[model samples]
Target: MVFSLFSFEKIQKQNTTNIPVSVIICAKNEAENIKENLPLVLEQNYPQFEVVLINDASSDDTLEVFESFSEKNKTIKIVDVKNNEAFWGNKKYALTLGIKAASHEHLLFTDADCKPKSSLWIQKMSQHFSSQKSLILGYGAYKKKKNSFLNLLIRFETFLTALQYFSYAKAGSPYMGVGRNLAYTKTLFYEANGFIEHMKVRSGDDDLFVNQVGSKKNISASVYPQSFTVSEPETTFKNWINQKRRHISTAKYYKKSHQYALGLFFTVNVLFYILAILLLSILFQWMYVLGIIGIKYVIQTIVYYNAAKKLKEKDTIYALPILEVSLILSQLVIVFSNMISKPTHWK
Candidate 1:
């Protein structure tokens, strides 16, 4: 709980006059997303940066969209990966190619389905890089829509995930980061062997790599509103559940220390709710159950409210109780699903 009070003060913007950065995007069948979102990244208010767009064997108009953008924008560099039998459906491989093709040492990564919150996104995220720091983790949020409970749940879960990782990072046990908004040096990527350890797994290009190389001193975090990226949420429950399962599959590869810490937290959380229900139903200790749950809720609301304000998440604090319970149940489902299944693709 003390970690919840971790400071989120924004880092002072560096003089990026000559510090060039390569923004990398790995896309497959993201034609509409690229048309809609790539412009926001291309129009960032930064000094010198190039966007390295990787077309990873898309069967759509994705290549045409990239070609159109490349023709008009000199900063856009297109890398086409077509019919590569070895690195067919792996995002890490595409990212490796993009990193190799990048002209700058500093590299920023984001999904094609994401859009920056502001033109200062590049400035805010890149300002954290220094000689000592090699990793910068930024907040990636889901766009809020009207009358959508699934959207709310997705956003709430994302907020809670961010809360845990950011708190852990600030507490000197940095573990994971979302690919939608993350940055690191090319040297750090190669030094850590460029996700070779977890490349066999489908979905670890961002979090697992960070878990391997990130340290308290070497990693920085940016939660400024201007640095945030917004991604579209899964509209259907089945799609969202599949996405959660795919993400959970990567957790087993995290370091043992992180696994233990996260496991303890999950165990306590599930037990807290289970015990509360049991006490109320059998023991008939309604007062005690209510009191305990009330205390926990109050503390969580306080911490989450502050974090949400920093991350610019609005209207979610009111749904904390429902969201927390739903998240616990969803975690149980995801863990169970992962136990009986193996993920084969990186989609």
Candidate 2:
């Protein structure tokens, strides 16, 4: 787990060639967000790129916002998606429509609520793409709140997720990528059949698709600080848990190997804490147990410190122990809750 930190290094060779890119955004009832963030996206510092906006059957004024933006910006193209009886509430269907409408082969994806951390977001992400590499994974972070514990939890989870996925991508078996700052090729999407296998499974448009199509040779991990997208974190724990339920529910569908790998890693961490507690209470080799635990924390803290610096979540390193324990307990609740009932809404 610690060795994966090496993968966080910036890409050494950037693709300088002007790659005409298509930025695909699928939004539902995001008029307010669009009004604030779309302008920054349109003003990106790139040679040639078009923003493809998909207003997915929003009841609000999302379509009006897209049209308003299109009128002023010639580079903006809109794809208004009607609700499909068969694929209702499924984001993949809306995203597929947006992908089809994209004018360029190189596709970059972000949510309507997200904005690039830097104008070079597209350049940094797209630079990793080449003839062999079809998929590019970039970090998507949440906005921090000064005194919000929920905000800390959200950002820590996002940081840890990026660390694992980036490491796995660097190792060759890429299991997932976040949608807020992911890129791929149009031909690659078509070749993979464009989410046809999991259209009904609402939340895996980004991670699940990458899990199906990602390979060691065809994928690249982009970690430059400029290659990030930031979005407002869920303000309430209830809303965040609901969102997490939808996201975590998709893991059961990953390939068997990935399922085993992720499951084993999580199991080992949980058992380590459980066994340590039991041993310390019984006074069974307590000294050795403490020594080993101390060593583990030292190493983990060092690695997390470096990773936090690279990922720009440095505040999280201070409360790593508390955050890890809280995250694990909450995830256990979510997993059991999901087993009892699946998340209803995808958005």
Candidate 3:
């Protein structure tokens, strides 16, 4: 029997144990975020951890911000890119440097714009390290919001995507991991060649790496609330769409099997919706339209509710279908635009 992309097996929950972790952050012009968010990294409750802040030639006040943080927090080391390198490009280089400077056998990674939801974030991630392992998958969420329809829209989009990936993982179809709060075995990273395959691409270092490794018994997920990191969302739809698009285009480089899995999903949902509308239109009945929307949302509510409950994405998952339909439309637009222009910065 062929391995199913959507399988029933999952990364069984195991007790993670004593192992030191080295946290890495790659930043460029992230001064505002660094000041507001970097302290959380320094103050994490985890005892045996070091943070390496790789300044990738930021032309802004990022250097000054790091210098201030470094003075107060000795655990924070500012590693600057040297002119010695004859060839270097985007963030992958900066991340490689951060990984090199990391001290622990296990590496926990997050962005400067992210903050731990709870103090135990480091403890939760490090536990997956076990006695001797090279990789651990973790989860991250968007910051909470109660005002503005836009904020709700953004949260809904983020929360739902989280459901699709993580819930899919729960069903045994783990594809990629998020960099905002991902951990890996330092040794395994080097052994896998460290982003060599997708180095030139602006994104996918996190997702593609996991795609390469696939699901082994060693891969683990953290369910504790304190372990998750929450990142600031792009305030505007245009900005969020651009950032998401760049990430999506990198999907083209995904492993064949993984690619087929995602394709199956997108194709299924889109085609199903289209077919439902066409078939029901032929009936020309209001009840059919209502039934279609109602049933879809019902299924969505179940999957998303389970996802939200598991991922700590709040109760927003119930609102997924409405958000998901819009998400699918926006995804199409962004993915199409990014085909011509590769977006680099998160506006």
Best by TM-score: 2
Instruction: Write the residue-wise lDDT of candidate 3 on 1-347 in tens digits.
Output: 11122122343465646467788888878999998988778888876778899888888888888889888887887789643354345677778888888877788888888998887888888876754445666777787777655566777776655555554455555677888888888778888889887776767768878777646555666756778888878888788887787778877888777789778877787887787778787876868787877887776565555556656665566456666677678877886787778777421
lDDT by residue (1-347, candidate 2, tens digit) is 63444534555767666699999999999999999999999989999999999999999999999999999999999999999899888889999999999999999999998999999998999988899999999899999999989899999988988888887787888999999999999999999999998877878999999999999899997778898999999998888888999888899999999899889978988998999899899986789989989999898888777778888899998898889988899889899889898787755
lDDT of 2 at 264: 90
User: What's each prediction's TM-score?
Assistant: 0.95, 0.96, 0.88
Candidate 3 lDDT score relative to the true structure:
0.73
> Candidate 3: misplaced stretches above 4 Å?
1-16, 83-87, 131-133, 168-173, 284-293, 345-347
> Which stretches of candidate 2 lie above 4 Å from their native place?
2-13
lDDT of each: 0.87, 0.89, 0.73
What pairs collide in candidate 2? none
Q: Each prediction's Cα RMSD? A: 1.8, 1.5, 3.4
Please give, for residues 1-347, the per-residue lDDT of candidate 1 as tens digits: 64564534344446543479999999999999999999999999988999999999899999999999999999999999875677668888888888999999999999999999999999888888889888999999999998998888999889888988888888888999999999999999889889798877768899999899989899888887898999999999878988988888888899999999899989998888888888899866688879888998888787788788887775787898898889888888888877888644564
Clashes of each: 0, 0, 1
Off by over 4 Å in 1: 7-18
Question: How many pairs of residues collide in model 1?
Answer: 0
